[model samples]
Structures are given as C-alpha cells and as structure tokens.
Target: MGKEILDLAEWKSTLTAFAKERDWEKFHTPKNLATALSVEASELLELFQWLTAEESTLLPQKNKDEKLRKNIEREMADVLVYLLRLATVLEVDLSKALQEKMAENAKKYPADKVKGLSKKYDQY
Candidate 1:
C-alpha cells in the first residue's frame, strides 16, 4: 500500500481537490458540512429504527435481511464521507486527537474500577 498520511494538511488538500473536481466547493462551507454530518447520521440510524439491538445485529446476516445490510453500508459511507470532509475543514488531526482523547479517558476511568462496568467516571 502507499504510505499513509497522518498530516491534516494532506487531508485538507485532498478534500479540496475532490470538491473542486466535482464542483462541490460551493456546497461545502463549514455550516453545510455540519448539517451534512447530522443528516448522514440520521440516515444511518434509520436502518435500525424498529429493531431491537439484538435484532439489528442479526439482521445483516440473515438471507432475508441482506437489504438491511446494504442500507446500513450505504448510510455508513454517507456518514464517513461527511465526517472526513468536516475533519478536513476543521483541520483536525483525527488519529492523534482520538488517541490522545482515549488516553485521557483511560486516566479518568481506570481498569481496576471500570472493568466490565458501565458506570460513569464519577461513579467509579
């Protein structure tokens, strides 16, 4: 595989190029990106609206339910695309920021008290 880029600058340029190529820059203002993110997330959630969590998990694998899986995949892509675009617009270092936030959360909720538990950090 080609070298992976972690720099936000590279991602921003990539997003800019994509927008320009498709004449989409006019539609990608920061406000529009935020709105798109919410819309895409709603579409993803619509896939599981009537199903319980257990049913939703199994629906993808049942022969009769492959359509649900396809819907899930499409909505997921929609969400991801807008997320990437939003991240680029905001110049967020997604990987580094995520790792740092996870580390902070680990300190806030240590393993000894939080293992197999769903309690809030303050409850621990």
Candidate 2:
C-alpha cells in the first residue's frame, strides 16, 4: 500500500491506536511518556557519545557505514516517537505550541544579537 501523508493528528491517532491495540494505554500517562521520551533522547545521544564535534556534525554524510547510519536513524525515530506520545498524552497542540515557542525564541534570540553567538539567551 502507498504510504499516506501523515499530519500531527494522524500520527497521534496511529500511536494511540497502537497503544490501544496492545492495551498499553494504561501505562501511557504523561509522566511515564515523559520519562520514556528522556530515555529515548539519551539513547539517541549515545549514538554520538564518543564522536568529536566535527565528527558528529559530519556523521550523516561522512559516515559510509550503512549499519551505523541505520542505528542513528532508528534512535532518532525512537526519540521522536516517545516525544509525540508524551505530547499527545499531555493534550498539547504540537503545531501551535511549536509556533508559540518559535516566536518566544525569536524574541529571546533576535538575529542581530545572536547571529554568530552560541550563548544562552540570558547572555545575549
């Protein structure tokens, strides 16, 4: 079957259905999902644990090892899945939340002030 283009709602519904089918919803509370999200994020970070800054930046293209690339991809997907699950459980409107967050960040880190700086917003 052809893959359907999935929006946030559809992705949330898919994850919800998968949880329901496996009777996993009982364990999918916001707190649990949040913890899972953090764990998955750590797993993703682990993929680059020993790499230098430049190596990490070049990982996606410079690494010719298909298996390593696949591992990175899978870890990234795990992080994203747990994040989406957490957001869904919290009843967050992801798109709206992202827009609001971007607006806040834009104010905090105005281009003129932060163009080449990697410092925190408070430092700007």
Candidate 3:
C-alpha cells in the first residue's frame, strides 16, 4: 500500500486501538463524544469568525496562508475523529447511516420542487 489508504474500517480500528491503549473508553460515551464533536466544530467555525460570507468562502485559497489552512485542517480532523469514535462506540454503521439520511433528505427536498431554491424542507 502506497500510504495505507484510510477507509472507514481502518480509521475505526485505529481510533479504537488508540482509545484502548489509553484506557479512555470509559469516558468515550455517546454523549461525551457528541459534545466533543460539537466543540471541535465550533473551533473550526472560529477560524472564519471575523471573515465575511464572501471572505469565508474563499479562505482556503484566497488567503494563501499555510498556517490558517493547517489550523482549519486540524480542527476538521478533530471533528471527524470524534464523529468516528462516536459512531464506533454506538455501533452505528456510518456509511449506511449517511446513505439513509441522504435518501431521507432527497424525499424531503425533491429536486423538482426545491431546485435553485434555498428553503428548508418545511418551507418548501
């Protein structure tokens, strides 16, 4: 393997091993993992706190700042890690859950009715 392609199973196993080695499974409850995920998401959002809508959209390329990019990447990794850990702890199939949720959303916001419209499903 060139760089050890990291699929969902590999990521889960890696995370599981890390947690097990540190004996942190006791504290990795669903609620705690969810809270940590939220906190990491907030930290990611803070990176664009002072930027305007347009500025925020172009943050990754327009700024050309490696440090800011790295910070955002790190925060994103944190969020993903927590999400994966939470799914593992809860025995939730992440891929299946994503597919099911996308199907639900498609029904809620059918393309024919919601195309080019930025309205919530209820509003539509």
Candidate 4:
C-alpha cells in the first residue's frame, strides 16, 4: 500500500507552493476560485439534475459540452483547494479517512446486493 500520508496543513502548503511555482496565485484568487467553483459545480450537477429516470442513465453517454466539462474539472480542483485549506486549518487527514470511510461504505453496500438496486442502504 502507498504510505499513509499528509497532514492537512501539509496538503494546503503543498498546493500553495504548487500554485506559486506556476505563478498561479493571481489566477487562483479566492473570489475567482469561488466563482469557478460554483460554475464547475453547476456543470457537474447538470449531469443529473431534472433528468428522467432513463435519461439519468444516458446523460453521461450523451454529448457533453466543452465548457461544462472544463468547468466541472476546474471547479472540482477549486473545491479541493478550499477543502484542503480548511483541512489544513483544522489539522485533519482527508485522504486516509476518506479511503477508510469508503471501504466501510462498500462493505455496507455490497455490490452483490446493490448492483442493480437504487434504494439507499436504510431502504435496502
């Protein structure tokens, strides 16, 4: 397994250093990042929002917009920075905990039972 790693502040500092290396600080202004985040998030949401049951399954297969695709990726990166910054401030370990939680959830929602099911765990 990869090493268990990265204090929150470390991730934040690393991200800041990366941005600085590329002179991305000006482009990464908090407000602009926030706006980009919102726009990117909207694109991700557009993937599923207001779709019919069948359409939900087909959306990803349908033609995608360049703007929406780029926005979604950009926004997700923006969100990650803010999240990392917050985690740094709070001194939390995001990656390890997330991996553990996902493992726990997979056990709870096993593929054998959930493969074709839509109801939540409580409903299942």
**Judged by lDDT, which candidate is best?**
3
Q: In candidate 2, how many Å is residue 43 off?
A: 0.4
lDDT of 1 by residue, 35-85 (tens): 999999998898788889899767757685878888888998778778788
TM-score of each: 0.79, 0.90, 0.90, 0.55
The worst-scoring run of ten residues by lDDT in candidate 2 lies at 57-66
What's the true lDDT of residue 118 in model 3? 97
lDDT of each: 0.83, 0.86, 0.92, 0.68
Off by over 4 Å in 2: 1-6
Candidate 2 has an lDDT of 0.86
Candidate 2 lDDT over 1-124, as tens digits, reads 9997648888889998999999999999988998888888898888889888987777678546677789889988888788788888888988999999999999999999999999999885
RMSD of 1: 3.7
**In model 1, which regions exceed 4 Å deviation?**
1-15, 60-64
Candidate 1: Cα lDDT at 11:
57
- Considering summed lDDT, which 10 consecutive residues are worst modelled in model 1? 4-13
lDDT of 3: 0.92
For candidate 1, give the lDDT: 0.83
